[model samples]
Target chain A: MAMAAFRREGRRFAPLLHPNSITAPRSSLIPQELDPEGVRFISTQVVRNRMKSVKNIQKITKAMKMVAASKLRGVQTKAENSRGLWQPFTALLGDTPSIDVKKNVLVTISSDKGLCGGINSTSVKMSKAIHKLNSGPDKETKYVIVGEKAKAQLVRDSKKDIELNITDLQKIPLNYTQAIFLTLELVLVDKSSQAGLISVLADDILKNVEYDALRVVFNKFHSVVSFMPTMSTVLSPEVVEKEAEAGGRLEGLDSYEIEGGETKSEVLQNLTEFQFSSVLFNAVLENACSEMGARMSAMDSSSRNAGEMLDRLTLTYNRTRQASITTELIEIISGASALEG
Target chain B: MASNAAAVPFWRAAGMTYITYSNICANLVRNCLKEPYRSEAINREKVHFSVAKWVDGKPQKPRDEELWHGNHA
Candidate 1:
């Protein structure tokens, strides 16, 4: 009966002072080498410190989620509006498949930073798949990685295959070379700096470029929660002309007449170059949108988890404090009764 | 089957390569885009990363000279 009464009060049975192991992410916020005996000795103090760290993490996660949400709206709008730019190119050239090609240049587009989700992985996976499907006897392949993340992932196994890794392009175009930027503004859109950047990069690419066809791999944003890695193929003007004669996969361009004095080959060459830049523009915007979306959702979940952890820690803190107080009261009562006896 | 012979593009006549011409075209299209998106598009493309080309399985050193003293070559 005496044991049952102690158990009922949970004074001896209460393991509240014993810290329970938390989930991975939350535990990482607290120090790993927590001494159990020390924790019991300092009871509520340890829980207070842990709660403080979790509260800070929760604040950061909440802030990140908000930032991503705001950025997504702008990027998502641009991505939607830019689809018209590449649609006509796909219709004209016809998306070149991976099964057949002579020499291929794969432009793998990825974000410079990570922590979004599996977006960069998906892009790298698609690029590898394309590389695998296209590599065989009589076929040649090379890589033109755009962002740092893609380069890091691809450099592991296919370092030898990488021809160019273009990064920090924004600074190179506007401030680095005014001559080219002025030329682009004079000929094309004077205010569109993105075009100037593209042209400048293209100039750099042309210096060390030789490929029969080019394939662009990037993430295509579908919704706030869903994204897909997409690959679009573009053939060189020379190949298109050659295939046009043979009535091969690229026969669609023949139906359209070259209105300018420039010959069909010249016009085709210009069109292919324009198509590449336009597609690149769209690809970058879509990837940016997807990154923001992924980050928003990732941060959202993180904050939610932090909230749950805070609740649990608060409960443990209250229960431990109450148990200690009850034990103190029991001690005083026992002492008083012994003195009376 | 050609009706009217349009003049050759100015960029072509100026000895500019197809790469420049294409950039010009993309910029033109970018300008034609409706408001907000145009600015957003322009803003999104401006990404600054400290990186270099990977040639022969090796990374080219970033331009240390250019990054210092705000000097661009």
Candidate 2:
């Protein structure tokens, strides 16, 4: 019965017994010789340290996930609400001739923080591709960067190409006013300059400028987890005119009426300018929301992965502890038996 | 331990008051237990000590006791 009890105990502590009995070619072959107490101490220390580190990581990820989710909700709502308002405005301006202007402008947006994974890298890569497509020694592309990470990447990769870098927009209020200001500052200022400068100078700037068509590339948020790079053209006057004519026919419209003291030409010009600002604002808001959604999904996945790791490590700790106990019990019983004999 | 206590912010010090109170109670039980099993129980108790303190509404203190217990246990 005692032997059977010993056998049962051995079975219970099989992990501990099996390792000791696995014959090493020599004592030197054993990497480290540790007593049961030593093994228990080291294992406990390792498990405790690892668990603490994992818990800390999990806490940070959880906080980031919550922050991202809150931001995503706010940004998504704003983007959706503004989309309908901007669509009609864009359609109205489609009839004007594109300002036969030549200026290259690139706007890039990326996340401020890392750990949400490849969002920043993807944005940077897309920006580089856009730069390659648009700019050369013969033709220069001006840049307006949003987010610190994107600004840093652009400066590093294409320093000569960048004209302006704007970072930390999240700290400031993002609104239509800001978008209009950016558009005026980046695109309109030079284009609106000197109708009488060297006609060739004006023509050179205006000819290649294509100021009316604004091309913006950004990640479009499909869901919390997935974002795809999407490019949308904000029409110059000529394209807008075409779109408006198409739209006007669909609406069974003949002439767009302008109320008050302005001529049709003046009203059209004012409306078209407002339309350009609206498109820029809408695109920026949409891209911001998409970035937040992508971050939320990435952090949530990281938190879940940390939990799984903690669970596996916990199981290993328990098994190791049980093994240590069993081995200790065997050694005590064997020592007592030897003394009695 | 003194440096840690000194470094703790006022809010965290208030949290630590609750943590210390609960830990004292737990240590009373742990100190009274026998060896081997005593160490194991203490170790297990320590692992959960911070969580217990957090549950009781204390925040900002590192779960030192629980972590110590885990290593020793």
Chain B TM-score in each of the candidates: 0.46, 0.37
The residue-by-residue lDDT of candidate 1 on A208-256, one tens digit each, is: 4567787888999999899989987777778878878888567777788
Q: Which CAPRI quality tier does the interface of model 2 achieve?
A: incorrect
Name the runs in model 2 displaced over 4 angstroms: A1-41, A89-102, A136-138, A188-212, A235-269, B1-73
lDDT of candidate 2 over A176-215, digit per residue (tens): 4455444543343333232231121232322122344555
Q: For each model in turn, which proportion of the native inter-chain contacts is also found?
A: 0.43, 0.00
Question: Looking at model 2, what is the TM-score of chain A?
Answer: 0.70
Task: Quickly count the clashes in candidate 1.
Answer: 0
lDDT by residue (B1-73, candidate 1, tens digit) is 1212356566655555565654446556666778988765554333344435566799776431122211111
Residue pairs with backbone overlap in model 1: none
| Chain A TM-score values for every predicted structure, listed in order | 0.78, 0.70
The TM-score of predicted model 1 comes to 0.74
**Candidate 1 Cα deviation (angstroms), residue A234:** 1.3
lDDT of 1 at A225: 94
